[model samples]
Target chain A: MLTKRIIPCLDIKNGRTVKGVNFVDLRDAGDPVELAAIYAAEGADELVFLDITATVEKRKTLIELVKRVAAEINIPFTVGGGISSIADVSALLNAGADKISINSSAVMRPELVSELAGEFGSQCVVVAIDSRFVEGEHIVHVSGGRIATERRTLLWAKEVEERGAGEILLTSMDHDGTKAGFANELTAKVSGSVSIPVIASGGAGNQEHFLDSFTIGLADAALAASIFHFKEVSIPDLKNYLKGYNIPVRIEK
Target chain B: MSVVIVDYNAGNVQSVTYALERLGVSPVLSADPEVIRSADRVIFPGVGEASTAMRFLKERKLDEVIKDLKQPVFGVCLGLQLMCAHSEENNTDCLGIFDVQVKKFEPTLKVPQMGWNNLEHTTGPLFKGIEADSYVYYVHSYYAETSEYTIATTDYVNTFSAALNKDNFYALQAHPEKSGKVGERILQNFLDIK
Candidate 1:
């Protein structure tokens, strides 16, 4: 019996957790390793550390950070952002990441998905689709939503699966910072079309939002940043809440 | 007294290495037959396609080395699939350690069984203190059919062997290294095997 996954994403800039992270424990709480451990203890199903580092030298630091986090947390780990080639995937997987997420590059060269899947297996590849509703339809966005492509969201989802991607991380740009809820409407369209697991990311404000993502959106996993990062919603409390709704989740004993 | 993680072209060996290190066991990650056979326990972990990985193993004759290993051998994910008689992953024949066939999960239910899932119908020492329905993480599309080697079973579209036990060779579809406490406990139980 597979349970719904709750993934807390940590955005790393220059090898350290950026934006905001709860320092609930430890002397220096900003470290991704500390945060990963805390999240693991809090019953997070998995952890995603997005390395937002730019430049050649800084990427090396991100790799080192990945190694530290992998050693600290025993749960499934994913590293994303700025991963463009097989070499990058190899480096991260070698550093102990269980999976690697490809966003812009996946949209740029869809073949990269199969290439990574061939080299590292489909289970290790995740194609993250950043989509925004434009002109009455969902359109794929690239370069962190700066430019929109003509690619239809549902079509792209199917393409990635055929190309050998194991999972799809569907993030709604409109709902991302708003926190109103997940794009259940768009998510259902994509999730229904694909056979692989779909992770509903962005716009996770409350427990009900997560419930909707799982039930209405039909997503295998739900991911959020601020909600989990700021301690506004603790994972244990949220999992208990979801369990009350009959959502199958792994609760701490 | 030694534990060695058999390394081929598998992807997620580092996590397995990290998991062992946390248990205070410094495991040697190796593809060499000598290092693998010499160890008290050998963990054959993998996260790749069946045919390609088999080619890598066969190229170096690691396949024979793995099959000849008399020590307690544990296979994970692709390793489990490859240890079976054949796999639908690439219509490739496998090492035949488990005497079962690996089939692709029907797309009607979902391809890869991602996230944390529980193991049921549990038995054997690998499960030990781990209760039935104890949640562990899994990420795989191909699964081994339930057989005499099966120690535990789980269902998605259909019930499959979540964990298998045959003599000294043990294999599970789940990634115990990344499965949190229950996972750690399973690994610890494997380590405690003497």
Candidate 2:
């Protein structure tokens, strides 16, 4: 009875959790370490810190931030963005991050997945696939959705799994920022196709969206950034709603 | 009392070190047999392939070191899996501390039982403060079936050993480092163990 996971993805830019911090109560909540503690205390199943930059120096800041955030929270923490090599992944893991997510780097070098999973474990490697609907086909997009590849979303999902990725963080570019809902059609297709766990990311406007991700999308986990940062949907409140719906979720008391 | 985290190049050692540090315990990460033998407590935390990791342990003779250590040792995730008799993972032979077999979870639901699950039928000092149905995080495909060493049980496609205890060795199938407050309480319990 492994419960479905609810993850709050913290978009970190220049070491701060960027975007949608308008909650009056957390007016001074720019620090990721502070935000992570609050989310972990409020019953977040896991936390993901995505360093939204490609700068080499920003990678250092991201690692430092991971150390600080990890120190304050006990739940599983995932650090992603700009992770390209075994050195980068090992550094983050050494700094206390539980899992490392590789996006564009993984797409550029699919072999990196097997190499990292070889050194570390598949359980510590998360391959995040950012996909967009392109002319009736879901195309894999990389470089934070700025670069589109010819690879099909479902095909790339299978590729990463074959490369020994433990989980897939599938993000729908069209559904992102729209809050309309997650791309359940694509998510369900990928989740059904892969043997590993699938984390449905983006377009999570409400608790119902999360429910859809689980039921319709068949996702093992759901990840959202704005819904959590803006305090529109607290982790405890969301978990409570999901619990009543009979979706198995960890309720931290 | 000194604490040493047995390091065999398996991942998740740093997370466990941080968890121990939060409890005001500084641990030394070492692969030296003497260092591990002399430590007052040892936390064998790991997350990796069983055969690959056991090979590294055997390479450094840590396999024998771990088996012979008389100090209180706590194994987490892959650490627990490696303590069992043998694992279906690569047909790997393990340390045999728990005298049980680790089998791959049947893909009745999901291959990897990822995320939190409740602990039930729990006993022993490892679960002293934790209540029934209290959740802990788990992320693995292989699990040891409930056995004589099983101190805690959980259901995930089947009843499996969540925690096991044999003499001075205690192990958990879940990653307590990532299991939050209840996990910290469990780590504290291990630190307080004589």
**Candidate 1 Cα outliers beyond 4 Å, as residue runs:** none
Q: Global lDDT of each model?
A: 0.88, 0.90
Tens-place lDDT per residue, model 2, A13-64, is 9898787765565646788888788888889889898888657876678878
Cα error, residue B68 of model 2, in Å, equals 2.4
Provide the RMSD of all predictions against the true structure, rounded to 1 decimal: 1.5, 1.5
TM-score of 2: 0.96
In the range A1-253, model 1's lDDT, one tens digit per residue, is 6899999999989888896776666567667888888889999999898888878887999889988888879898889999999999999988988899999998889889999987887888999999999999899999888899989999999999999999999999999989899999999989999889999998998999999999999999999998888888899999999999999999857
- Which docking category, incorrect, acceptable, medium or high, applies to candidate 1? high
Clashing pairs in 1: none
Which candidate has the highest DockQ of all?
1
Question: Per-residue CA lDDT of candidate 2, range B15-116, in tens?
Answer: 888888899989999999889999999999888889989999999999999999898999999999999999999999999999899999888877778889
